[model samples]
Structure formats: structure tokens, C-alpha cells
Target: MTETFDLSALKQSLDAAPDHKNLKPLGLQTIYLGRDALTVLPDVVAAMVDATPALGPVAVLSDSTPKRYHAGDLLSFVTGCIDARHRVRNVTVGVAGHTVHADEETLAKAIRDCDGAACLVAVGSGTVSDIGKAVAAAQGIGYIIVQTANSVNGYADDRSVLLINGVKRTIPTRWADVLIVDTDVLVKAPVEMNVSGFADLIATFTAPADWYLATLLGMDDSYSPTVVGLARNQGSALLEAAPLVPQADPNALEQVAKTLTLSGISMGIAGTTAPCSGMEHAVSHLLEMATTKAGNETALHGAQVGVTTIVAALLWQRVLGEIADGGLSRVRVPGPAESQAAVLAAFHTVDPSGAMGAECWRDYERKLARWAHASERIELAKRDWPTHEGTLRHLLATPQSLVAALQSAGAPLRFADLEPSVNEADARWAVANCHLMRERFSIADMANFLGIWDDDLVDELIADAAALGSSR
Candidate 1:
């Protein structure tokens, strides 16, 4: 018999976890998810008022893009639900080009403009919600998310990915006080957006492996098998619902939305992004940086991540295959000086002024220091490769499997599928350079340090991905 996912019940269990108790008591206090979720907004707001007592005016932060349903515009649809007694202010963050970034300056401006607002209602997708969360945190105000699309997992996460000095960085932020997911609105979203959410959930197939690798190396002490297990429990169910995503099947959309939300909650429980993001996300971030630098439109974060997940899966397959074949050998790890030189050289082409290179190195340096400090654990991992090989293999999905899921979901499986299309050269560059862009340890970092992630290996992985995409 197949087990059904009851999000409310699962959340209760999570709330009782030892980790949740140890951390500051802050997260989604109420989550209303259903077809008529919007109708309950007034009740949710009233509950918020009763809880906070001194709550002031509510500021609804959103973008200029008009998200609509069969009834009408989403903004007006939402406003109609709020009680007449509540003081409400609508603020548009203003969009530019094809996307709106959750940048620091923009968030700072939002905080200043919405000053004195007691609570913020984030009324768009991931980016809007991220900005709202940051602004709320800065002003010590309550926050709620009226999710407009299931485009990304940041909707429920406590961390916001913001651009700092032109470099993308994930900083700590607060979670929403309430989350309202209206299926009527979600089903009206563009097919691509919903598919993107499915693709983001696909990262679960590979990300846990990277997190396990980090745990084995003793770099992150907060690793939790319980959290990973919670996510894995729903992995196959989400993939099974992929085909229905493009059709905007309400049930399927709700499943995807729930899985994405659970993925975020796993991160919240662990107090790190390790559970849901890994080398795959690093590749996406690198591509985002390059696209922004070229002044081109960037693909949806989950869409980019979906494609990169295949690459990361293939890399893991190759690494595990080699280990199983007894190809393990000791190689000298690069020191800080050598690693710094490589980082600068790799990023110099991306940013000639060395600003981006400097920013990357500043973060990469910490990773190197941790790697150096964990030499014993690394050695232990190398020594026990035989024992760990099966675990890695079981945790990751094949590239072909990932490609098929994306194809069924109507998501882009290759660079060509992305808007403004990332080419072969760009894809290869992202694969080769992603490890330098983030301080997190991932399979990319492992491959780089082990001297296996060279140009030839990158070409092999890219070719394999292309073959898989074409085969489907």
C-alpha cells in the first residue's frame, strides 16, 4: 500500500524534533493549503492579530507583474479576501527586465519604504517571498507568504539568496509566520513554472549524497539522516506526479507544492541548506552570475537546477564507478595559496576587474581551511570507500532517470531548453568553475580536490547529459 502524505501531521512531528526545540522558536505557525486557501486569509490575519496584540498595518509586498487566475488578477483576488477593518498597504517592488532579484539594496529600500508595517504579505514567487522575509527580519515585523507560484523552494526556507556586491550569497533570514497556498492560483500558473518546481524537487535525488559526503568528512556536524529520510520518503511520489504537472492537474500541483515545502522544512530543521542544495545548486548559481554579467535573461532557478542535477548525478555515477572498480588513489590536496591562485585564474575570465574573483576567493578560502582541518576524516572516507560506495549509489538517481522525469514534467533537460539558452561552452564553464563560486563542500569540490574534475571529465559529463537528453 502506498502511504499518503499528510503535511499537517508531518509538520507536527517536525515541530517536536529535538533540533526544532533547540533552535529559536520561529517558523511557519500556520499553513493553509487547498483550493479555497485564499478564502481563509481573513481568518489567518485575524489569528495573527490576536497572537501579536500590538500588530500594526499590514504591508503586502509584491512585484509589478500581474499574476492572474480565471476569476481575475491575483492582487485584487487577494485584496478581496482581507477584512475591511484591517489596515492594508500594497507596495510593488518594481520589476526590471525578465526577472526581479532579491538584492540587498532592493530589500533595504523595501524595509525603508514599508516602515512601521506590523506584518508583510509576500505575494509572488520565490524572489518576492525572499525579499519580504529579509525585510520583515530587518524590521522585526511578522511575515506571511501568499504563494503565487510553486516556482522555487525558497518560499518556505529561512535563508534568502541575495546579491551582495554583485555576487550571489545565501544569508540567514526568518521563516514565514503563516503560509497560504491556493491551488486555484497555483494551477493557473504557467506550465513552465510548475515544472520548474518539480525539477527543483528532483535535486533530492542527488543533494542528499553531497550532504552525506560532507558528513563523512566531518565538515558539517548538523547533518541529519532524519531530515533526509523525510525528504526521501516523498521523492518517488513527486517524480510520479511529474507528468501531470504540465497539465496543471490540481492534485499534482498540490503534491509538488507540498514536496517543495517539505524540502524547505528539512533545511529549516537542519539549520543549513545542505539537505536540499549541493553542487547542482552551485552550478545554477554560477550560471545565474554569468547570465547576469552578460546582461541576458536568466532561466528560472529550479529550471537551471533541474538541468544541473543531471550533471551532478552523472559526476557521482562516474566517481562511484571508479571507486567500485578499486580506482582509489592518494593525491595531494591543494593548499590555500595554490587553491587561491586557481580560484583567481578560473574567475578572472568571468570578471576582468577581479572583483568577482576576489569575492569568490573570500568564500572559497574558508572551505579550504575546513578541508585542511578535516584531513583525518577525508582519509577515513578514502579508506572506507568500499563501505560507502553502496550508500552513494543508492542515494543518487541516474542521469537518464532524471532526464526522463524532466521531459515528462515539461521541464528543460539541457542547456538548450533554457531561455536565452546556455551553450555548450557556458555549461562546461559552469561545471568546471562552480566549486570556486561557493564555500559549501560538494561533489564538485570533492572531484576538484581529487584531481578528477578536469576539462576532459567535464566534457565527458556534458556529452553524457546530451546523450541522455537526446535519447529521450
Candidate 2:
């Protein structure tokens, strides 16, 4: 039987864990989930006011897009709600754009401008919420999230994926003190947005395998089954609700929202994004960077992640096949100089000025150093590949399964299906160069270090993914 997740019960378990004392406080105090969740806005504000009696003005941060409901403007709606009860001044910080970026300049300006605000209530989706969290952390103020859409899992996470020096980096940030998910509001969001949210949650099926692989290779020591299992526990439910997402069914929207929120909390518990982001996320980030550098609009983060998740699943299947065929015994670790040269050369194609390349190497070198120091663990992984094969397979969904899930949710399952339309060449470029773009060690890194991911293998994986897409 599949396990059911109760956030309150899970929080209690986390608090009671023997290592709980060492764990950083998630800072998430309350979650208001249901229809009429917006009604609790005053209560959230009052709680913050009680905690910080001398709290300054409250800033409501949001994008310019209007929600598809009777109360269309999320920021206006929130401001009006807070104005009715609290005498605290509420200021609206509207980031100019339908889609705002989580970059250093934007965040710095938001933080500098909202310096005196004692509380921040994010009134949009993932990007707005992430900006609010970052600004709150910078200003040392409490934060709350009034989610307008089920778009991504960053809502409850303590980390923000910000662009630093043109490369996407997952930086530690603050979690919201309260998270409000109103199903009525979520159901009014664009169906595509809801589908993208479902797609993001689907990554739970594949990301944990990458995390487990990194643990086995000793590249990351912060792996936890408790945290990872929390997300996995909701997998079957999310998949069951996937087909109804396109219709904006309230039940389905609530299920997706709750699961995605739980996913962010899982990241908080693990103190890393590794539990929900892996090689697939690297692929999405690479594609986003390419589009941004080319002066084009990027696709939805979760949409890109969905398509890339299929690719990662296929690559893992192939890697496991190779191991089953005695490939692990033939694995050869590369020298530091060789790995650095490869990373640099791979990155030069993405950025000719070498700045991005240097930034990537700065991070990748740490993983390489860790791998060198943990040579014994590497040997153990090689010798134990067969023993852990079943567990790895269990953690991943098949390519066909991912494709069907994306299709059911009306998400982009292929490059051509993406918004802004990623072509075959760019998608291939992302698959090939994704490992070099991040310091994190994923299946891509493992494949590259083992000499398993080459031009021919990339072509094979691309062909396999394309076939899966066509089969849909």
C-alpha cells in the first residue's frame, strides 16, 4: 500500500528525530491549505505582528500578471485584505514583467528597496515567492506566501535558484513563516501552469536516484531516506491526479499543490535541493541560460524540467544496463587535470569569454576534489553496483512512464513541445553540456567521469527520448 503524507504529523516526526537538534529550523510556522485560504491572510499578518510587535510596513511582492478569477489582481486582493484588519502600512512591490527573474541584481534591488518592510507576502507563483524569501532573508524579516498558482516547488523551500554571474546557482535562502494555498485561486490559474506544477512534482520519481548515486559515489554526504521518502510517498497520488490537472479540477489542483509544497519542505529537511533537483534540473538550467543569452524568452521552468526528466530517466536506464553488462568493472576515473580540461572545454562552447567557464570550474573542482578524497567509496560503489541496482531502478520511472505522465498532465514531453520551442540541436546541447554547468554531481557527472557519456551515447539517449515522445 502507498503511504499517505500528513504535513503536521511529518513535522512532528522531523522535530522528534534524534538529529532534529542539529537541523536548522525550517522557520515554516503554519500552512493554510483549502478553499477560502485567502481568508486567513489577516490571521497570518496578525501572527507576524504579534511576534514582531514593532514590525515595520508589510510589502506585498508580485508580478504584473492578473489571475483568472473574480479577484483578478493577486497583489491588489492581498493588499485589500490586509488593509481591512491591520493598521500596518502595506506596500505593493510589483516587479515589472509577466515573468520576473531570480537574479542577483533584481533580488538586490528588491532587498534594498524593501529594506524597512517587516514582512513580505509573495502574491504570485514560484519566482515571486523565491524573491520574497530571498528579500526576507536579506532584510531579516518574516515572510508569508499567498500562492496564486501551483507552478513550482520553490514555495516552501529554503533555497533559491538565482542567476549569479550568468550561471544558475541554488543559493540558500529563508523559508516562509506561513504558506497559503487556496485551491479556489489555484484552480483559476492557467491550465498549463497547473500542468507544469504537476510535472515538477513528477521529478520526485527520478531525482532521488541521482541523489542516491551521488551518495554512493561519496560526492554528497547529506542524503536522507526520510526526507526523500516524504516526496515519494505522494507519488502515486500525484500521478493519479495528473490527468485531471488540465481541466483545472479543484481536487487535482489541491493534490498537486500539496505534493509540490511537501517537495519544497523535503528540500528544507535535507538542507539541499538535491532531493528534488538533479541532472534533469541541470538540463533545464542549461537550456534556460542558452535562451537567456540568445535574447529569447525561456520556457516554464517546470515544463523544461518535465521533458528533461524523461531524458534523465532514459540515461539512467542505459547506465544501469551497462552496469548489468559488467560496465562497472571497466569504469576508469579521470585525473583532475583531465576532468578540469574537459569541463573547461565543454563550457567554452557555451560562453566564449570564459567567465561562465571559470565560474563552473570553481564549483566543479570541489566535487572532483571530494571524489579524489573518497576513492575508497568509489571502489565500493563499483563493487556493489549489482547489489544496489534494484534500489536504483525502483527510484526511477521508465521513460515511457514519464512521457505518459507529462501527456496526461498536458505538459511538454519533448523539445518541440516546449514554449519558445526548443529545437533538437539545443536540447542535445543541453544534454551534453548540462553536467559542466553545475558543481553538483548528478548521473550526468557519473556518466561523464566514467567515460559512459560520449557523442555516440548522447545520440543514443536523444534517439531513445525522441522515440518515447513519438510513442506518446
Candidate 3:
């Protein structure tokens, strides 16, 4: 099922890029790319063990999913160099590495219990990789990431976002010594996971707007066109491979998975989240953080991002049109006094905390107010304006027909199905608290800034979106 590609043409493209001067060592050193790549794990482990001799006491981080276990069959498939003592004395396999909830303490404890392992082989997608990355980095131990699902482009980056002190924070991490992916394993994953990955990938179209916005505000350093171009190309591949997204075609899944892997690495190269995320991601992060606080559990990371990507895409299109029609030039920058009032008006439009049932609303307001005081808040809003627009556009831009296309392909695009989560209130709360999540102003905040964020509008959109989801 491999969709054939011109390998020589790709090589020519690579060659045409001109043996550019090494720009500070780009990307992960170990790339286990290509189909059936995971079958070579033992040899890879043996080689790495030979190289980094200090790498001792291997602890394996595994997932509880049936898919990962099925994928483990491939790990077990590696014919040579099996060490029982290496596994028994040093191995700490956590079935809940990422699928369930293993915090820093839990994971560290597991590794420490395993005779103080020096390396952890993480055998799954983003979550497992994050845990492995964190466990290794925090303990001065290096780890390798085995990608199980092409769900998100998090594997290639040096940053690991985890719950340290009960709050999500991104800590810098080293790259995996080996980036392994059994294409066969990825092929067996639920098609929805693949589609969600694509939706997240397509978000690259809007991220440059974020970079442009950041630069316009004189905040960030230079934005790289090369990295952006790379992201967009990967995104395009995901779409082109959309038709072949199920039952894990080696050719199709390889295209999607490799693009996804490179997308993760692209973020690593960019040294910023902008390469793979935009306002859509911020919206997802806000909901995720809120759900965590609410004691709610179990929402797939990619699903939330997928839904928000749709919304952001729609909003982005709307804003893109306005900007193109001279909205930026026409609108004058309001004075701080006027700006404050407009923002406040926007806030109250959505928040009716004065009412009896608004105790929760008032408390959230306190937090929202604190977020507003951030020094760079307005600048992020102004600069990232168009990308925020693109995020909105992602919503309307992706036709329901496409969601159906994804559905026929087995993807989930609505909120109702996001397990560990079934509440629209979380989505509503996220939209309501838009201004609080990040400094980069998203469409939710733009709705407020543009005088469209009202209880009625928010209510209608959430209800309509959820209804659309339920219908699906």
C-alpha cells in the first residue's frame, strides 16, 4: 500500500537546497526513519550501547493501549541480542507511562526502583516520549523515543511539557539518542488518530501569522522561512495522503508518519512552538489546563487540538479577509484607557458574574484579571492578529464535507467524543477564558476585542459546534 514517490526527485530537492553551511547542527542526530524501522531496534540498541558505554540499566516506558502492546510484538520481533539480565536487572516497564497518568514522582519512583537505570526506552507517541524525556532529563539520564502513533509532532523537540508541582510546564530536554518508529505499528493505530495528526499538521498554515505577529510587536527574534516552508510541506503531505489513512498502509502511513516526525523535528529546528502550533493550540492548552484543575481526566491531546484547530481556522479566515480589506489600516490603535474599557466591555459581555449563579464566573474573573496585567499581552494580540484570524478560518475553512471525509477515513472532529472528557462546558470555559490562556491574542479574544464576544455569541457557537459534533 505504499504510495510511490520519486526518491531521486526528493534527493534532488535535498541536493538543490545547496550544501548549506551547517546551521548549528540541525535536528536529532539519530533518525530511525523509514518503514519497518523499528525491527532494527536491537541492533540500534546494541550499537548505541557500544557508543555511549555509560548507558546502563535500561528502563522501558510502555503504554497500556492494546495498540502499543500489539506494536510491542514488533519490539519482541527484533530477532537478535536479547539480554534477560539487562531487562530484568535494569528494566522498569510502566504500562501506564502515558496512556494512564504517571506523574514525575510516579515515573521517577519506578525508575529508581529499577536499580537506578541510566537510560529509558520510551515505546509510544507524544505522552510516553514526554514522560521518558522528563524522567531522563530530570535525573541526568538520557533516553530514546519510540514513536507509536503519528498523533502529534512533539517527539523531535528538546522541550518536554509535563506536570511538575501539579501544573503543566515546558522544561528543556535533550534529543533521543535514537528516534525509532515501527511503521507497521503506526499503521495499525486508529485512523482517527492519524487524521487528528493531520489536522494538527495543517495548523502550520496559521502559525506563520503568529510569528509575523510576534515580530510586528518587536518581541521575538527572526522567524525562519525555511522552517515554515518545511512545516507547510509536511502538512501538504498529510492531506495528499488523506485518502490512504486507514489500516496502516506502509506507503501511506509512512508518508504521514515521517512527515509528522519531521514536523516534530522541525519544531526542534525552529526552537519555537510556532512551527506546529498556532492559536488553535493555545485554545487546546487552555482547556487542558482547566480540565486538569477541575479534576477532570482523560481528554486526548490531539482531539482537543483538532476541535480548536477547526474553530481557529474559521476565525482566521474571517480575520484574514478583514486584514486583506484594510481592517488593519482602518482601525486606529485605541488609547490604553479606551483599550481597557473595550477589553473590560468584552469581558463582561461574556461574563455575567453579577448574577446569582455566577460565583464560579467571578472566581474565574479574578484569574482572568491577573492574566490581563501581563506586560506583553497587548503586543501579542496585535502582532499575532492574522494567524489568530487563520485559526478562525480553520473552523469555516474546513468544510463539514471534509470532516465527513475524515469520518469515512475514521477521524473524530467533534467535542462529544473526546474521552476523559465529555463536557462542552470545558470548551465553553476555554473560549470564555480566551484572554487568560496566552499573550498571543486568538480569535476568542479577538471576538472580544472586536465586540463580538457575548454570552449569546459564545453560547450559540459552543452549542452549535457541540450539536454539530453530536450529530456526527
TM-score of each: 0.94, 0.94, 0.73
lDDT for each candidate structure:
0.81, 0.81, 0.57
For 134-157, candidate 3 gives per-residue lDDT tens digits of 667766655677777778778877
lDDT, model 3, position 109 = 66
Point to the candidate with the largest lDDT: 1
- For residues 378-437, could you state the per-residue lDDT of candidate 1 as single tens digits? 668778787787777788888888898899899998888887588888899989988998
Candidate 2 error regions (>4 Å)? 1-8, 15-24, 53-55, 86-98
Better of 1 and 3 by lDDT: 1
Clashing pairs in 1: none
lDDT per residue for candidate 2 within 1-472, as digits (tens), equals 1112355777788788765763455667778888777887887787786788555677778777777545576666788888776644443344446357777778887888677776778888788788888888988888998888888998988888887777888888888888888888888898888888888877888899999888887888777777777767678899899889999898898889888988898888788888899999999998887777676788888999998898899889877877788765666767878877877787677678877778888888887778667668867877767778878888889888899989988898788888878988888888998887776789887787667888888878878887888887
As a TM-score, model 2 comes out at: 0.94
* Cα error of candidate 2 at position 450, Å: 1.7
Worst 10 residues of 3 by lDDT: 354-363
Q: After superposition, how far is residue 209 of candidate 3 from its true place, in Å?
A: 2.6
Report the Cα lDDT for candidate 2.
0.81
Clashes of each: 0, 0, 24
